[model samples]
Target: MAPVSLGVLASGRGSNLQSIIDACRRGDIKAEVKVVISDRQDAYALKRAEKHGIDAYYINIKDYQDKAAYETKIVELLRRYNVQLVCLAGYMRLVGPTVLNAFPWRIMNIHPSLLPSFPGLHAQKQALDCGVKVSGCTVHFVDEGMDSGPIILQACVPVYDDDTEDSLAERILEQEHKIYPRAVGLFAEGKLIVRGKKVFIREAGND
Candidate 1:
């Protein structure tokens, strides 16, 4: 079978992007990163993609007249690459309706917190502030809302009494690297089924 082609959008250092790249190279995920797009020119994710000989692009929002135009350009690039899946690795922009309609449930994002709890930025800080005993990461299908998508997988870590935001984030990141790729692998294997707000995993060899 041909491997699933992935297009990653990122704005930061892209540790999650690196994890996906590494997983693909190790055959741990039946997918290949076709291209990477960043909104910032200096993002390290672009460099990571280029180092692996993958196509990388920087699409500045300032270059476009509106958010819709910017996302339309993104959709164009994804289609050009024949990308089968879209992954957001620390991408700082909310996906607009254009891209959402284009890909539907084909988009995936890895959030730093057990979502529906802390959805936006500084998730670790939010968990720490609330004095949550357990904090974790979530891999979910992307929707129009901010991290409000249905969950696919989650890995929990105990929040120590002395844990700072950075400490909790560091531990959660380790699990993020592990499960993000696994979620992608499941998608590649056609095991994900979305029903209403729930995602069901098909049993192996069922199809």
Candidate 2:
């Protein structure tokens, strides 16, 4: 089967980007990251893509006149690469309607908290402050709202009594690394279904 082609958008160090790349390299997922796009000029995700021989481009949100124009460039990049999926890994910008409409359910994000709980920035700290005994990460479809889409998958991490925000963040991130890739793999493999604002994942076990 031909692998799903992906365009990853990230603004940070690309740890999740690297995780997907490593999964692709090991054949754990039947997909390839076709390109990396960043709004920031100095994002390290570009370097990671270049190292893997994938096309990397920076579409300056500052260069465009409005949000529509900025998203137009993003869509252009996806079309240029014939991308089948888009992944947001720490790509701090809020995606507008243009990009969401273009890809539909094809774009996804990994948020640091079990969404519907702490939905925006500083989610890790929010979880810690709320004193949740169990905190986790969520992978979900991206909509116009921030982290307010239907859930795809989640992996929980226990919040230790002595856990600090940073420490708990690191732990939840490890789970993100696992579930996010699995979510993408399921999508690429035709194993996921979305109906009536809920996702129904087909069980793969031989029960």
Candidate 3:
């Protein structure tokens, strides 16, 4: 089977992006990262993509007139790569209508918390502050709302009594690396079903 083409959006260190790349390299996922794009010019994600011979782009959001304009440019970039999937690997920005309409359920994001509980920034801190006994990561379909998308897969980790934000974040990140690729792999295999706000996974031979 031909590999699914992916367009990844990321900010910061992009450890999750590296995980996806590593999975592809090992044939663990039937997909190829066609492009890696970042709003910030200095994001290490671009460097990681370059190292893998994948096209990397730094599209400055400030160059555009508005959010719509920025997302329009991103839509064009995805078109250029014939991207089948748009994965958010630590991308801090919320996706607007332009890209959402273009990709619809095709976009995916992995968040640092179990979601519906802690949706926005500093999720690890939120979980820790809330004094939750269990906290982890979630891979979900991206939506217009902030991390209010349908959950795909999640991994739970215990919140130790002495755990700091940094320590909890580090552990959740490990689960992110595992499940994000698994979610992408499911998408590549045509095993995902998104109905309303729920996501259902089909058996391998069902399709």
- Candidate lDDT values, in order: 0.96, 0.90, 0.95
Ranking of predictions according to lDDT:
1, 3, 2
- Prediction-by-prediction clash tally: 0, 0, 0
Q: Which of the two candidates, 2 or 3, achieves a greater lDDT against the reference?
A: 3
For candidate 1, the per-residue lDDT at 63 reads: 93
Model 3, residue 159: C-alpha shift (Å): 0.3
Give the alpha carbon lDDT tens digit for every residue of 5-60 in model 2: 99999998899999999998899999999999998889898899899998899888
Best by lDDT: 1
Per-residue CA lDDT of candidate 1, range 59-168, in tens? Answer: 99999999999999999999999999999999999998999999999999999998889999999999999999998999999999999998999999899999998889
Q: What are the TM-scores, per candidate, against the unseen true structure?
A: 0.98, 0.96, 0.98
Please report how far candidate 3 places residue 106 from its true position, in Å: 0.4
lDDT (0-100) at residue 113 of candidate 2? Answer: 89
> What TM value does model 2 have?
0.96
